[model samples]
Target chain A: MTYIIKTNNLTKIYQGKEVVSNVTMNIKKGEIYGFLGPNGAGKTTFMRMLMSLVKPSNGEIIICGEQVTPTSFELLKRIGCIIEYPVFYDKLTAKENLDLHCEYTGYYNKKEIDFVLDLVKLKDTEGKAVKDFSLGMKQRLGVARAIITKPEILILDEPINGLDPIGIKEFRNLFQKLSKDYGMTLLISSHILGEIEQIADTIGVIKDGKLIKEVLMEDIREENTAFIELKTNDVKKVAFEISHTLGISNFKILDEATIRIYDMKASEGEILKTLVVKDILVEAITRKNHSLEDYFLRIINGGGMNA
Target chain B: MLKLIKLEIKKFKLFNYYKGVLIANLGFIAFLSMIYFLERNDGNIPFENFEMAMNISSAAIRTTFIIFAAVLIVKLIIDEYKSKSIEIMFTYPIGRKKILTAKLMIVVAFTFIMVMSSTSLMAGLLYFAEAQFDIFPVELSFQDIVRNVYVNFFYALATAGLSLIPLLFGMRRKSAVATIVSAIFLATVTSTTSDNINLFSIIAIPVSLGVFGILIGYLAISKIEQVDVI
Candidate 1:
C-alpha cells in the first residue's frame, strides 16, 4: 500500500537537547494509525513535524505526496490537526468557531459546518457558547472543527486526553465510522491504549523519540501471545508440578497465588489434569492475552513481545 | 492571503470584546454631553471657555485613544500567543508574514474607524447642543470647526500609529501588560521631555516615530520568523 505520510530521519531539538531524535515513520493511506507513547515521549513533536508547525532540525516529512518544508502551506491544506489542548475563543458559539476554522481551511460552505457538527454529534450544540462546554464536549468540538473541511488526513495528538469513557467510546465510533465511510487517513496519539487498540488499524510505539515498533493490527492479533493465568493457593508447588509434569518451562509466576503460562504446548486441559493429579486444586484458570496496554508497557519497558 | 485575513478577522469578532468597546465609546460620548449640559450657563460663556474645553478634550481624547488602540492591538496578538493557537494558525495556507500583516492591519483599521466615528459623533453632538442652548456666545465659523476636525483626524491617526510601538513590544514580549506599561512609560517620558532635550526636539516626533517603526518592524519580523512556537 502506498504511504500517505512518510518521514526520513526526522528530528527536533529544544534548548540544545534533542526532543525527537533521528526517526522515520510511514503511515499508509486510508488507515487509522495509533501513536502510543508516554507523556513527553515526542508524540506531539512528531505530529507538529508532519503539520510543518516547527521546522525539523534535520530530515523530511512527506504528507499527501507533498514534501513538508518550512512553509508548505499547500501540503498542510489537506491535513487537519489538534497539536495539544484544543483551544478556541470562549466568547464564540460552536458554529462561530467552526466558521473561523472554515475560513482558514478555505472551506467556506455553511452546510459543511453543520455536517461536521453532526458527524461529531455536536449538532445540538451549534449555538451554545464554547466557554460553557464540558471538557468532553470541547474535545468533540475540536474534532468537529478539525474535520469541518473534510481534510484528507487528520492528525490528532492526545485527542481524548481528558475524555470520559463514554466520550472515548463515542470518539472511537466516530473515528471508525469516518475511516470506513470517508476513507480518511488518521494519525492519532494517545496514552489511552485501549481506545487506540479499539480503532487503530495500525499501531506505532514511540519511546525516547525513536519508533520502536510498527505493525498492522491484523498481524499483531494473528501473532498474539496467549497468557494462561492460573490462581492457586500453592503457586510455587503448582508451577513446579506443571513444569515438571508437563515438560513446559515457558511460564511466569505473576504473584504469590498466580502463574501465567505462555507456552501453547501445555494444553489447559492437560495442565489442569496434571495439576489435579498433583492434588493442587486450582481456584481459577483464565485464558488471557496481551492487551494493548500490556503490549505498550512491555515495549516501553524493554519487554517487547516478538511480534 | 485574503482568506487568511478574513479568518484572522473572524477570530477578532468571535471574542466580542471589540463590540463592547464600540458601546463604551458611544456611552462615553453621552456622558461627556451630559456633563457639558450640567455645567453650561445659558448664552454667556466667552471664546476662551470654548478654547479651554477643546484643549482639555484634546488631551483627554488623545490619551484615551492611544491607550485603547494599544490595548486592542495587544489583545488581538497576545491572545493567540497565550493560547498556543498561533501554532495552529501558522499551519494554515498562508505565509507567516502575511498573517501578522493581516492581523496588524485589521487592528489598525478597527482603531482608526472607532476613533474617527467616536470623535466626529462627539463633535457633532457638541455643536448641536451649543446651537440649541446658545451657551457660548463666541461664534466659531465652519472653517474653524473643520480645522478642529482635521486636527482630530490627524490626532486620532497619530494615536493609532503610536500603538505600533507597543504592538512591536507585545510581539517580542508576548505580554499585553508589558506592552501597555512600556508604551505609557515611553510616550510619557519622550513626549514630555523631548523639548527639554535638544537632540530629541531637533529630530521631531514624526521622524522619530518613522525610525522607530522601521526598527521595530525589523525586530518583529526577525523574532516572529525564528522563535519556536510551543
Candidate 2:
C-alpha cells in the first residue's frame, strides 16, 4: 500500500505544553482517512503543521515522498485544505473569491470555478458577497474552494460542521466521489463517529494529543460483536442455563433483568423453547449488534471493545 | 513578485483606495490655501521666505500621508494577522517572504508616490500662485522651487520607509488601534516644528527613523517561515 502522506514522531508544543505529541501516522493513497477527535484534541494544529502554517516542534512530515520544510512551499500545490472555518475576502463575491484562490494556488483554469460551484450546489449565489452567506452555504463554498484546484491530497477539518442533514449527506457523497473518481487522498477530521463511520475507509482516533487507535472501518465493524440479550426477572437462572444447558461461556449478566449471551449454539427459537420447557418466564429476548459509537468510545477508553 | 503584489491588490480591492487619496489631496490643498490666506492677513508676515512655506507644507504632508500609510498597513497587514487570514495565504505555493514583501511593497510604494506627487503639486501650485496673485512680498527663484522638489523627493522616500514603523507596534499585538495610534504619534513627533526647523529638517532624524522602519519590516519577514501562524 502506497502512503500518500506520512508523519514521523510529529509533535507540537505551545507555552511548555504539548498540544500534539509524538503522532506517527500514514494515510494510504486515494483513501478517505478519517481523523477523529473531540474539541481541543489538537486536530487543527496537526493539520496546520501538515500545511506548514505551523512548524512542528519535533519530527517531520513527508508528503508524496518529499520532506516538508519551511521553504518547501511548492509541495503545498499538491494539497488543498480548510484548517478551520473557511475564510475569504468576504467583501468580494463568491466568484471573485474563487478566482483569487485559483490565482494564488496557481491554477489557471478559470472554468474549474463554475465546475466546483456546481459540484457544491452553489451555482446561483446571486452574485452575493461571501459575508452574506449562511453557515451552511459557507461550508459548501469551503468545500468548493478546497476541491477547485483538484489537489492530490485534501485535508479538511470538520468540513461538514454547519451543514444540514441533507447537506451532510451530500458532502459525504462528494467526498466519496472525489476519492473514488478523482483519485484524491482525503484526510478529513471530525468528532462525530456516525458521520465519519459512514464515509471513512480508515479511522484514527485522537484524544488528549495522542492517537489511541488507527484501524480500518471494516476491522471496527468486525469487532461489532452480535450478542443475544434476554430481559427477564430471573436473570440468575437464565445465566446458569446459558452456561450449563446452553453450554455458552461467553456471556455477561448486566443486571437483575438483563443477561447477555455472547455465544449461543441454539437459535432464538430453540433458546425460547428450552426456557419455556424449563418453566422460565422469558419476558423478551432479542439479538443486538454493537454500534460504532460504542466501539469508538471503547478505543478511546483503551480497550474492552468486545465486552 | 510583481504578480503577487498585483494579486494582493486585487484580493484586497485596493484600487478603491484611490478615492480616499484624491480626497486627501483636495483637503490638503484647501488647508494649504487657508493657511496661506490667514497667515498673510493675520499680521504674521506669512511665509516670510520660500523655505518657510515649503517647510510648513512638507511637515503637513509628512504627518497626513505617513499616518495614511499606517492605515494601509493596518488594513493590508495587521488586519490579516488579526483575522488569521494570513495563515491561509502562507499555505499557498508562494514563499512567505515573497508574499510579505509584495504587501510591504504596496504600502511603501503608495506612501512614497503620494508624498512626492503631493509635495511637487503643492510646490508647483505655490509658485504659480506667487507669480499670479503676489500672495506675499516674499519671492522665489525658479531654481529654488526646483531644488525644493528634489529635496522633497528624498523626504518622501524617507517617509515611505518611516511609514513602516507602525508595523512594529501593530504586529506586537496584532492590534489595528495600536498601529494607527503609533503612526499618529510618530507623525506628530516628526512633524512638530519651531522656527522652520522640525525634527525632519535635521535630515539625520528622518533618515534614521526611516532606516529603523525598514529594519522593522525586515524583522517581521525574517522568521515568518518558522513562526506559527497562531
Candidate 3:
C-alpha cells in the first residue's frame, strides 16, 4: 500500500514527560485518517510534530515520501493544516487573511481564494475583519485558508471545533468530497466519534499518549460483532435463562438489568421467549452492530481484541 | 530572502499600528522643531553648541524611533506567539530563519529610515530657523551639516540594531510587555549615554551597541530553525 504520511516511532517529550510516546502510524493517500483520543492525549502534539511546529525528541515523520525536518520546508508546500484553533490577523478582513495565507504558500490565484471562500461558505464575509467574526465564521475562514492552495495533504486538528451542527455536517461533506474527488489525504483529530465514523476511511485510537490501534473502518464494519442487548426487570433471572435454558455461553451481564449476548447462533426470538417464560419483563431489546465509539472505548479500556 | 522581506512589508502595509507609528514619527518631528524654535535663545536650552545640538536632536529622534522598533517587534514577533499565528507560519514552505530575518530586517530598516529622515528634517528646519531669526551665537556651517548627517546616520543604524536586544527577550518569552519594556530601557540608557559622553563618543556608543545588538540578533536568528516554535 502506498502511504502519503508515515511516522516511525514518533515521540515528544516536554520537561522529561512524554507527551507523545512512540507513536507509529501511517496515512494512505486519498483517505481520511481519523485520530481519536481523549483530551490531553497527545493528538495535538503529534499533529504539531508532523507540521514541524514542535520538534520531535525521537523518530521521524515522512510526508509524501520526504522526511520532515525543520529545514524540510519545500515539502510543506504540498501540505495544508490548521493546528488547534484557527488563528488569523484580527485586524485583517477574512478575504485578506486568506490572501496572506496564499501569498505565504507561494500560490497566488485570486479565483482560488474566492473558490475556497465559497467552498467554506465565507464568501459573503468580504468586508468584515476577523475580529468581528463569530467562532463558527472563524472556523469556516480557517477551513477556507487551509484549502485555498489546493494542497495535496491536509492535517486538521479539531477542524470542526466551534461550528454548529449544520456547519459540522457541511464540513463532513466537504471533507468527503475533498478526499473522493480531489484525492486529498487528510489527518483529522476529533472527539466526535460519529463524525469520524461517518467520514474516516481509517481510525487510529490513542490513549495515554500512545497509539493503541490503527484499524481500517472497513475492517471494523466487517468485524462489528453484532450483539443482542436486553433491558430486563430481573437481570439474574435473564442471565440464568440465557445460560441454562437457552444454552448460550457467550454472554455478559452489563448491569443490574441489562445483558448482552455475543453468541451469534442464539436466536433473538428464542431468547425472548425463554425470558418471557421465566416471568422476566423485557423492557427493550436491541440488536446492535458495534460502533466506532464502542471500539474506541474498548481500546481505551484495554479490552479491544485487535490492535 | 528579498521576497520574504517584501512579503513582510506587504503584510504590515495595512497594519494600523504601522501607520500609527509613521504618523507619530512625523508628529514627533514637528514637536521637536517647535521646541527648538521656542528655546533657541534661552541659555537653559541645550542647543548652544552645534555638535551638542546635533547629538541631542539625534538622540531624541533615535529614542522615539527605537520605541517604534520595539512596538514593531511586539506586533510582528510577540503577537504571533500570543495569537498563535506563528504555528501557521512555521508550517509554511519557508524557513523559520528566513521569516524571522525578514521581520528583524523590517524593524531595523524602518528604524533607520524613520530616524534618519526625522533627524535630517529637524536639522534642516533648525538651520532654516537659525538663518531666518539668528537664534543662536554659533552660525551654521556646511561642515557641521555634513558631520551631523554622517554621525546621525550611524546613530540611527545603531539605535535600530540595538532594538534586537528587546526583540530577543520578547521572542524568547513571547511577551509584548517584556519587549516594550526592554526597548524603553535600552533607549533610555543609550540616550543618557549620548547626552553625557563627548562628541567623539556619540557615534562610538550607538555604533558599538548596534554592532552588539546585531551579534545578538544573529544568534537569535540562527536558533529559529532548531528551536520549537511553542
How does each model score on TM-score? 0.80, 0.95, 0.90
True contacts kept of 1: 0.68
Candidate 1: C-alpha lDDT = 0.74
DockQ per candidate, 2 decimals:
0.52, 0.87, 0.78
The residue-by-residue lDDT of candidate 1 on A1-307, one tens digit each, is 7999999989898888888888788999999999998888899888877777778898888887778767677777788888888888887899988887777767768898878788777889756899999888888888998777778899998999778888788888888887888899999998878788888999998888878888898887766688788999998898789778888888888889999998888778988889998888899888987776666687889834432
Per-residue lDDT tens digits for candidate 2, residues B53-117, read 77888888889998999989988998888777787898899999999999999999999999999
Q: What is the lDDT of candidate 2?
A: 0.89
- Model 1 residue A287 CA deviation (Å) reads 5.0
Task: Rank by TM-score, highest first.
Answer: 2, 3, 1
Query: Which residue pairs show backbone clashes in model 2?
Result: none
Q: Which stretches of candidate 3 lie over 4 Å from their true place?
A: A230-259, A263-270, A274-289, A303-307, B14-46, B193-203
Best by lDDT: 2
Clashes of each: 0, 0, 0
- Candidates sorted by lDDT, descending order? 2, 3, 1
Q: What's the CA error at residue B209 for candidate 1, in Å? A: 2.2
lDDT of 1 at A209: 83
Error of 2 at A209 (Å): 0.5
Per residue, candidate 2 scores C-alpha lDDT tens digits across A139-197 of: 89888988999999999999999999999999999999999999999999999888899
Decide which is better by TM-score, 1 or 3: 3
